[model samples]
Target: MAECTEESTMCDPRHALLLQSVQSGLPLVHRPYAELGQRIGMSETEVIGLLSEWVAAGIIKRIGVVVRHRSLGYDANAMVVWDVPDGRIGDVGRRMSAFDFVTLCYRRPRQGDAWPYNLFCMIHGKDRANVLAQIELLAASCDLTDVPRDVLFSRRCFKQRGARYAARALAAS
Candidate 1:
């Protein structure tokens, strides 16, 4: 494979336009990429192919549907926090993010003595049983059996809304 260079990513004018096309977001259609292609003057295949290449090159970290769970019948969500070592945090974080049940996973800067946990994952479900089972499975699968951790379930969901990259997203359900 050819090396992905700084110039290819940063200096390309088409790349900038392409990024902008989706910055606000692709049209809320059945085929978002096809709509994007039509607007950007590229074939749907070309658009998808380029995106696939970008993902392979790690230019795009991930493509995911960000659902506002509380609005979608998920009543309980646990913010599972881990006090993992700095050296192993990256490995642990990646492993934690791999779980399908882990809806959101990221790291936070440790707040010294007040807060010791660095890595965090959000697991949302209708009840605690399913969420707890997922946590157990995650711990075992990721070799996090004895890691220092805490599970904080949400008492209330004060804010529940999907991310607004575009002005609208179609919802037929």
Candidate 2:
């Protein structure tokens, strides 16, 4: 896999445009990208090509939606952090990611004395207690009894979307 860098050539004009469109997300319309392309002075085919190229060049990671789970009746969401041994981190992370209940899982950099967890997982449920129980079951199944973890429940959401690329156009101009 190509490593992410700030000065990568993949951050070209088309890539920038694709980033802007992705950050804005698909509009709630029958032809969202086509409409978006019209607004941005490009055809839908061109936009799709840009996205495909960006993905090929590893400039963009993944494109997907961020559903408003709470509004959709999913009231519970928790960030579960685990401190797995260095050798087992990959194994544990893969296992967690394979679980349907585990929506997101990755190894984040460990904070100093405050936080030592490296493996992080996000779980969603209908309620807080249900989510907690699910986490406990997951831990047990993974034979992670000795693993130290903490559950951070979200209380509020401010903004959730991809990055904007309008600034790139402005900079070019």
Candidate 3:
């Protein structure tokens, strides 16, 4: 096994190749790594090591799947935004993130005039009403009654993929 240095972790050829392959999200078969390794001039173990190292170094934020909610019967998904005080945004975000039903929670730059929300969360459920109920519960739990909020349900999805940076890197290479 090659000793992975900090520099090697960032832009090594093997790591780059593994990143490109993972970003593509092609179906992983019985010998997925081995097949990928063959194309990238590495063995399966080497590919695994490169990925593991990248993860440890925070180069790879996550390895996961993106499911189409509508196809899976979870048709109702909403982007719930809150106009939380700057001081309490972190506390509110932490509380929101603690909920299993809250899939994504983060702070975003407030859009002037139309959008006043600074904190955002994503809630998914079987129906729009169910999703609203979940958001209501979340708001009550976070003592967010005084805060203004809006829920934006996605009407259409243009594109969804993992690791946009990885895709750009592959394109560059």
Which candidate tops TM-score?
3
Candidate No. with top lDDT: 3
Ranking by TM-score: 3, 2, 1
- Residue by residue across 1-173, what tens digits does model 1's lDDT show? 22234544533445544565765555788999998988868788978888888799997777777666787889788999988888988998898888778888898998987888998999989989989999999888877889888999999767654343212221110
Candidate 1 runs further than 4 Å off? 1-10, 23-25, 28-34, 38-46, 61-67, 87-91, 94-99, 132-148, 154-173
Go through the candidates in order and give each one's C-alpha lDDT: 0.76, 0.78, 0.80
- Residue-wise C-alpha lDDT for candidate 3, range 1-173, written one tens digit per residue: 22334544436555666666767774578987788888878898987787787789887777677687778987788989999999999999999999998999989999887888999898878888888889889989999988999889988888765654444545555
Candidate 2, pairs of clashing residues: none
| Candidate 1 lowest-lDDT run of ten | 164-173
The candidate 3 region of ten consecutive residues with least summed lDDT is 1-10
**Which of the two candidates, 2 or 3, achieves a greater TM-score against the reference?**
3
